[model samples]
Target: MKPARKLFLGARLRRLRRDLKLKQVDMAGKLGISASYLNHLERNQRPVTATVLLRLAETFDINVRQFAAEGGELAGPDQLSEIFSDALFADLDIGRQDILDLSDHSPGIAEAIGRLYTTLTETARRQSPSDTSDPRSLITPETWVRDHIQAHRNHFPALEEAAETVGGALANRLTMIDTLCHRLRDAFGVNVEIASSTDLGGATQAYDRSRRTLFLNALLRPENRAFGLAYQLSLLEFDAILTRMVQEAAPSDEGVARLLHMSLANYAAGAILMPYGRFLESAERHGYALDPLCGEYNVNVEQVAHRLTTMGRTGAEGVPFFMLRVDPAGNVSKRYAGESFPFSHYGGTCPRWLLHLAFQTPGKTITQLIETPDGERYFTFCRTIERPIRPTLTDDHLLAIGVGCHVRHASRLAYAEGLDLAKGMATPVGPACAICPRLDCAYRATPPAGHQLAIDETRKTISPYPFLAD
Candidate 1:
């Protein structure tokens, strides 16, 4: 055919060779071809035939179509072009081809650029107060929730199946925590005792490295005890599996990756305790109700919700859920999810949602449907939980925290059946005024930092709230 057509295969082959970190001589030897002949093929001096392509595929354990397509690849250039177009690079003096070349030749540079961009963005957000007010601001609270969910790919079929299987046995045992304690004693011969008043100075769960004994604090709530037991069990049963999963997840942040590793280990422990199939059946039988599920498992609302997101493990998968833990001032401490939820880079922005209102009605579950300016709707449930700061001391105080989740998949919940979701509907809320374009909001605290404000002495519009457009 034409010279251009011939060159396509050559370029793809070159790209693949580089991606595999293979040298020309090594690849030529594997293909039983001369280095000179391979070089000619890569330069489009010779066309790659079907038989050669098949042989290459067999040798590399790749598909024949993939081998053939690699000979004349166009995908890499397109992807490189897209990466260079990112807003982070908008002000930088760079060309699309330069980015492609860098990505092809030096992936490290591209990754460095990404990290730098993230750091700079974070700095900008912290410096500007108005940035915090914009519901659409990149640093809003929803970002953390979204990232946690994205990290897990919103799937946990194994955990769900395990919960269903052990849920019934756990239901009758007074508490999942108690059942786990018993399991520890039976399986490992480790007697788990909550520490009494005299033992208050020691660690909550201390493993006598010398005696091989395990001691747990007696004062811990049932859920916390169960979680501790499961966490310990994970270290014994699935350390290698957890390591493998962490490696596969390839988290960008070391802290987050470490947390994910520990979380997965705990998840494995929970799976071993509950098993997947039984939990799924119980969840379905119970109509996916939170209170019943929590009672059945001797867990709390937050724990139940956290476990619900893990139910994607087996045949009975539920809608992916995202969970967040935030304080009164809108600071998020923890977030986990099984689906992609959009928010700013930092946290969630939508302020009008029940999550914000839940702060006003402390110690109660607030349910509401929130709609964003973009018309995306989410059903949300929120409530506050308290934990004492110091359990051993008589004067120890309690800290109140709010936990929330979206109802995108709440149809299976027993509590969701009779609720009227449409009446007196309030529009979804966003984080702050800076990022949110809703100019008419009565809650606008200050003008967006980067936006210019308009002044009108003649007349005033109710909603235009005079912010100068940048």
Candidate 2:
């Protein structure tokens, strides 16, 4: 038999101690170990024993699996690998092991590098107007909120509990839209009214906080009407929870804090609409099929898709899925994840990914098996969805929702039917044309940034942009 792997979690231990603001002696005493022993453990001079690991978990109320993992932070390893893969660092010739070691030992540094990369990429996109970047100022409020949500794996227990309470109170109600409206009026004294689109000044929904009234555009569908009512109810009913979450996030500015608050409120609304216990049961019973869940919960497919990304409750967790919604112009409007999707931080996504093709066949579900450049395969499904109508605004709104999980979880999904999953062919895709490392993609729209182009004056290759192999 092979030897058991030794657990040397020095960096994680040290980081934990620092985070808890405990000195080595204090931590050692709490762990029932000598300070010298703790020091040795922190230096990786000795492997952590099972007893010590258990003690650490008990003392800190943290999962020991985090200590065992190479990187304590969930997003660290992948972000580090992605950052180091840039051609700017190509000359360094860093390998996967080195990246893992850095992520393991110096996670704070790794996080700092990730932040720098985000800023750099955001800045670059700003210089090239044609490139896709947040239209807001350089603060990147959306990026901050996205990172915050990903850090928590898109689940918030407090919000879930509040939503469950609301849902239970309204469980016996037959008409959800009417139920939501009645609850809003009875609980918060806020009257819900459908108003002409011209009166709302082109907004889909507007709330008069002082007057305690909500105005929803007449053009909104029944699903959107219910959503608007639920969103308003969440804001009024769970303001404290939402505020606490935003404060805990410690966003860079007030704008980002407000955005985070709005996002949490949206999560609360979804949870309230589809309570955790009932939704998870229906999802599993239907093999996680999108349409059945939509019909069961009286929600739209986009709502169901977004809800799937938030099914990361501790004990009753569902499949860890990542979701993205993009318009025909390739603008990603909504992205949430219980799993990392390796989304591009700078420019547009890979054109070859089936998500782009979803616009062609509206209202039809299409599934594909795709492999990233790193050889990680996933099973994904995409379908077109229309945004909620705003009669006063321009009417060209259409979007595609793409949801996927790792290939290991494919067998559990209804969309993965009839495929030889073990040996099935997967279309190879990468992050974005600007950063993708795929050297021979025929559909590459732009050359890989920061790499020397492999120019051939004599002959032409299938790929439009060829770069030197490092």
Candidate 3:
């Protein structure tokens, strides 16, 4: 029998050593190996022995399987190669050896190059009118926030409990605002002032800590002012808690981390404005109706819908729902999932989905029974909400907010009224045109990623690119 082939794991060994913040000599001493042998192993001149691998695992407190894995062992090199394959590098006659040599010897430079290309690609993709199916497209701070939200299943019981702890007539919307206003004045000796949008520079809320004043954009609809107040409260009252949450993320990008912190603070604001128990009870009583909930809570429809998804308190759970808000250009600004829906992390949603049509009937709730490529059925509803930057600004900020739940729970939704869901009368939709596999879809923007392009000169197919088998 042939002996097991020795593993040439140069990159992994180097990465492990660097991650431990140890020099070659220090790492070699810890592993009970000579520094010269370690250097040879790190340069792929010598194979990693089983004994050294065991020592590595024990010393680094890492799994042996990590070293056994081969795919990401040279991921920097592979990613650098992919970066070169972009149109920007099309004119250059770059070779495999050049890429490998640079990545292996100067991994820092290789990583920097890869990051530059990804940032440029992401910036271009973001400028496009449509949300992209590119996984890298969600590289924005919003995606990171979505990740943390999804990890918690769109619920933060701690935020809810914290809101409970900061109670001041929170059961009543008007009373809660009054109480928060009092707290703002009494606790911080700060006066809450509403100013014109121009004065506030289109910001929903801004705080002047030195002046001991909080400025809210007066252009915001009256229903939204409470949220602005709550947002400011989160920043002022629970800043340490908020900072702790952000620190837990330990994001490398300060800008992205700051944005994520703001997003989470907004969540805390919403959670406080609508304390969980009272809001949850009202939601169920109102059949999860956005308008009634909005009226009941004195908040906007977007706030009510957003708050509904955060109702995932264990044992006291609401109907599992997903919410998506897309701008007119098809950029998804907000996304939350209570169940596994076909939401693409990298790209725009299916054009055939009801939200695009909801734009036509602006300010009106539209409902439809939709099916994903995976045959999952949901009862979804959407309506457009205007978010004008200021009183003088144009109405380009219209965003369509959609919320849906499984067909099994559709009966509980007011939007699913009078729908014959049993007969399988669901309109098929998917994550995005680029990644969707349904061939008959007329609105597909691009060919599916996994399928090959079979452009027939002699014949024409219904779809633009005739999809061939993988």
Best by lDDT: 2
Better of 2 and 3 by TM-score: 2
What is the per-residue lDDT of model 1 for residues 317-406, given as tens digits with 9 covering 90 to 100? 555555677666776665555443444433344555556566567667776666655455666667766551245457423222332334
In angstroms, the error of model 3 at 364 is 0.9
lDDT pick, better of 2 and 3: 2
Top model number, TM-score: 2
Question: Can you give the lDDT of residue 313 in candidate 1?
Answer: 43
Q: Counting only residues 3 or more apart in sequence or on different chains, how many pairs clash (N, Cα, C under 3 Å) in candidate 1?
A: 48
Report lDDT (Cα) of residue 302, candidate 3.
87
Candidate 2 per-residue C-alpha lDDT over 297-346 given as tens digits, one digit per residue, 9 for 90 to 100: 88999999999999877557788888988888988888777766677654
Q: What lDDT does model 3 reach?
A: 0.73
Instruction: State the lDDT of candidate 3 residue by residue for 1-470, as single tens digits.
Output: 65655666776788778757899999999999999999998887887788888888788765464354432332344355556645456567566568767765655566567556655756765765243454443356665566656645677666778876664344456566676778789787878888887787768778998898988877777767777777887888788887888887675466668887888888888887778887888888888989998887778888888888888775577887889999888888888876556566556788778888888898899888898765768888899987834455454767899899889888887776677876758898876565566777777777655455788899877778767653
Pairs that collide in candidate 3 are 131-348, 132-346, 132-347, 133-347
